[model samples]
Target: MAIHASPRVTEILAQKYVEPLRESGEFAHEIVESLRAYVDNQMNIPAAARSIPVHVNTLRYRLRRFEELTGCYLEDTSTVIEVSWVLEVFGRDL
Candidate 1:
């Protein structure tokens, strides 16, 4: 919170991740929500899907598309941490 609120870091992080997701247009919210759910569920696809009440395949597709758009692989620990941090920074903004 300090880092995000103290400077332009919030904007920077948002530009790096959120903006690209937003480019997905109508699907932006869906993808972001899916990502939040996935991360919150500890990357457990089934759990994430159940939380979202979406099909497993649908969550999988959103995650895949998230990777494609952000060029960030969810399989990487650092990537997940970084993405999670970015998500935290934006929160409702996303």
Candidate 2:
């Protein structure tokens, strides 16, 4: 699980996916945090929700909202990969 570690790549990915979430305001952090948990939990809704200490329904809503806002499907490999990298690189700052 090696990141490209390219600053430019991170910047671009952040701009495309992560930035929008940030621009979305305070709730955006919760969304990104939920997404990170979702990915960390291997996309298992229950597991992710538990990890976040949130209700499954809440997590589901956040995920759905994320997809709706970003137009990036979690079920897509490319989206997941790019997002995973962005999370690894810029997640803390976001």
Candidate 3:
């Protein structure tokens, strides 16, 4: 028999993965905004930093902190998947 992934299971996993970040404080909010902007802009770090009005180093630092808090690197495959889900689900709110 072949195991198949279900939509309900995927939805649940997506929600579980996104809940913490959604509930986090201002830092997470900023990080999410920054990340979304970066992803939306095709992963352009300098452009994102400029758009967010922060220095590149500051943006990088915040991104590092975000990775630490979320225990997921923004560049990682799984994290990218989760981030994409979050962006799709809540992009308008951010």
Q: Identify the leading candidate in terms of TM-score.
A: 2
Alpha carbon lDDT of each predicted model: 0.85, 0.86, 0.68
- TM-score computed on alpha carbons, candidate 1: 0.86
**TM-score versus the correct structure, for each prediction:** 0.86, 0.88, 0.69
> Counting only residues 3 or more apart in sequence or on different chains, how many pairs clash (N, Cα, C under 3 Å) in candidate 3?
0
Candidate 1: give the clashing pairs: none
Candidate 1 lDDT tens digits, 1-94:
6764645765666677787888888898899889899999999999999998899999999999999998889999977887787778777557
Clashing pairs in 2: none
- Report RMSD (Å) for each prediction in the order shown: 1.8, 1.7, 4.8
Error of 2 at 81 (Å): 1.0
For residue 51, give model 1's deviation from the true position in Å. 0.2
Candidate 3 C-alpha RMSD relative to the actual structure = 4.8
Error (Å) of candidate 1 at residue 63 is 0.4
User: Residues 9-47, candidate 2, lDDT per residue (tens digit)?
Assistant: 777888878767866788888998898999999989999
Question: Candidate 2: TM-score?
Answer: 0.88
| Model 2 ranges with Cα > 4 A deviation | 1-5
Q: Which rank order by TM-score, best down to worst?
A: 2, 1, 3
